[model samples]
Target: MSEEDTALKAIEQVVAAVQRTQREKDAEGFLALFHPDALWTTAHGKVLIGFDAIADFTRSVLPGASWDGEVTYDVVHTQFLRPDVAAVKVRQLYTDAEGRPESEGAPLYVMTRGGDGRWLLTACQNTQVRAA
Candidate 1:
């Protein structure tokens, strides 16, 4: 596969890992998609750094929620900053326990290729979309 193809595959893996986490409420599974020092910022400007913190946050948020449907992600774009660094924009959509449409604004993810040539999330930021 070409370098772009490989990088895209890695991004897909990360997205798939997120889906699995949603299904199983497995924070550890979600943490596997990130680098050890990854940074995550929510639309509300809350920031969480490192895989352990991310795992803890996920565990706290996912289990008590009663979600009847799966969360879905739509990749908006993928940009390769270099052979080893890439960024992706994606839209996240889901329904909350109250049956309200819970859609996070578009989020950007920065990924870096590790020494093993696998892409791991380095940073993520969510852009809040005001309700119309």
Candidate 2:
């Protein structure tokens, strides 16, 4: 595969892992995708400035998250800032227990490839779609 294609595939896998971890409610698995210095702003507007903050939040919220829905993540768009960095737009959906759409989100994830060429979530902002 070409360089761009390879990078895209790797990024897609990272997003897939996000979806899977969320679906499984595996907090540690979800946290594993982040960079050590990651920044995460939740849909609720709470800002997590580092891996520790993110980890604490994820552990507290993910495992026993009081949601009657399942969440999914899809890569909607990607912009390469450099060969090692990318801005990824993700479509996030929550499906209720009855399988109906519960809510939606537009999240942006800034991902970067480390020295090991492994893609990690660096900076992320998640916004929920709300009615006007």
User: Which one wins on TM-score?
Assistant: 2
Give per-residue CA lDDT, model 2, range 40-107, as digits (tens): 99999999999999999999989987678788899999999999999999999999998899899999
Clashing pairs in 1: none
Per-candidate TM-score against the hidden true structure: 0.83, 0.95
| lDDT string, candidate 1, 1-103, tens digits | 9868877887877877776776787766777788999999977888998887877887788677566766766777899898888888987777676657776
**What lDDT does each candidate get?**
0.80, 0.95
Model 1 clashes, total count = 0
Off by over 4 Å in 2: none
